[model samples]
Target: MSTGLGRGAGRRFGSGWISGVLAVTCGALGYGGVLCLLFPSWLTTPSARALYPLELVRFLIYVMLVLGFGLGALSVVLRRRKVLGFTGIALATAGTLLGGSSAEIGTLGGTTAVGLDWFLLNLFILALLFVPLERVIPRLPEQAIFRPGWTTDLMHFAMSHLLVQVTVVLTMLPAGVLFRWATQPWLQDAVAAQPLALQFLEIVLVADFTQYWVHRAFHRVPWLWRLHAIHHSSETMDWLAGSRLHLLDIVVTRGLSFVPLYVLGFAPPAVYAYLVFVSFLAVFIHANVRFDLGPLDWLLATPRFHHWHHAANPVDKNFAVHLPWIDRLFGTAYLPAGRWPEVYGISGSPVPQGYWRQLAWPFLR
Candidate 1:
């Protein structure tokens, strides 16, 4: 019976219809768990409590993020049933935001810390889930929008976000140690007395500028490109594809961007708010949804705008993340009048076969 089951599995592996049904079913179950189990507990938690409410809300948010990502993975694997995968993602995302807001998990110290932990936990879970899925699914067709090979992309995204969380935690150590060593009485008092809006703006400007340079460096440098290249190697751009970044690249880039915000005496409140806003945009820009931001694209980075940066041709453009003014100032902005790239990914380099190989290849190459 075991041998027969194994043979049956082998036969079913090659059938797109069978795999598509399985993918949609898995996504439905996973997403249903979040809506039915996690959302209510989080929403009903008391807002007056300090840690409990924050913790509950954070957990729910993480569950939603994980579910949305899982649905995205299933979408690619079960290409024939694209609508089911997309609907699952939409439902999970709505549930996550609703649950998070319902708990009133404001960007305070306790809530901020809990949110970071939630992000990291979700990444770990997603990475573990995708490893076996990659082995089971066959490679997708060249021109196909949903690639069965997307398990690698999901793993990359998970690892990158996890690394960013680690970097943020590490930043606290230096901030604490430096405060202990220097003991700046006046600066400490000033920071404590600073207005939240002013402090928030200061943090935003400093972080934006720091990230601007870090993003530019990724394009300029060679060794760094090896790791960063994973993000651009996706033949089909989707929500999961956005997660396909090298862990090392994430650590360095996010660390550099985060450290300045810490050192600049930005209020912790401001940092928390800024991180949430930026994190949402990062995913939004990488998402595969077809929405054109006509005039708004010039003011801020959009999917259509950022997608050009990942294009194989016209390599020298769109390096800035939030503000395009920096790119325009540096003469690196490359968006043409009402046009889009036909192809994306590394033009000549061999695409990595799997997540583990992609992770190791940066060092080995």
Candidate 2:
């Protein structure tokens, strides 16, 4: 890979842009095809059910097929990067042909549901939103769109998104099994009876407090630190970098965090709302967009607050992911007034570069 550009200097457009477009196109097609063939039951995502009808999604797939072929043809005719363009077209065609035939639509009752469609949709929407935001109000103005480790981070993002079903299952397993023993219908009923606004607040408090301690443990414990360090190894902080997490980290943090929420028994609607809100905040806090939250920074975690957590100069502080007050309360918080870290990433990170390698890294060394 080429050396990453400093602030404001963009990557080489021809190689970077073509490769990226080809990668995303091929990745979507490949994932879509697999879901269609082996896991048709998992195709319908929660976001898809809530947002659009199945027919609309089908129409969009058809449109994508045409666009992919058109782009491939144009690239081949122009004799510019024909290989990538052709590969993208081929994948797109195959995926469309394989997955286009849908017998039924809407949300289906099942034990598993992958967020493939949701992932792609989010990829598009977030790219549209954050790409511009980063470019205009970039925290690191010189950072290129296609940074050195972008592909690795993209793989992490794709895997996490694609394996949403598995993740959900693994995360809920603790809650499911443990809550079975502590089942209290009356407690759940009482909790659900509360106002939606109040329920949301309670859910946030329960989840964040549990996560804060779990996150701290992942840092202080040497064994767990091996896994958590993958998240801190990214040299550049962006919306996508947030997805570079080890599977162990995800399963442990999310699974343990779910315990309190389940035991407390918040309503499904409020729980969903809190999930949506935190999801947005997770990406937002990692985003490259520069903003001054001022007083809000102390109350809530923002990009600036979270960025400091990833800074090489002080890698041990800012363990809180949601509420800054949690960090402040525990005395792990470290934020300077009107300043950003001059550097990011851990010093001499042992975490490997690729997704597969990082997955096995914790077990090895």
Candidate achieving the largest lDDT: 2
- Which lDDT tens digits does candidate 2 get at residues 1-365? 24354322222544334443644464465446335434545764554455666566566566556656666665555443357566667766666566543423434567445676667766766776788899899988888777878999988888887788778889999989877778688988899899999999988888989999999899899999988999999989998899899987998899999998888789899999998898878888898978887878888888999999899998788877788888889999898998888888988866779989988888994
Top-TM-score candidate index = 2
Worst 10 residues of 1 by lDDT: 40-49
**TM-score of each model, in listed order:** 0.62, 0.83
lDDT of each: 0.59, 0.76
The count of residue-pair clashes in candidate 2 stands at 5
Off by over 4 Å in 2: 1-39, 42-52, 73-79, 95-115, 179-183
Which pairs, if any, clash in model 2?
Answer: 6-142, 7-142, 7-143, 8-141, 8-142
* Candidate 1 lDDT tens digits, 127-207: 344323333331221223345567787566545543443555665655455545555567756864688877766666677
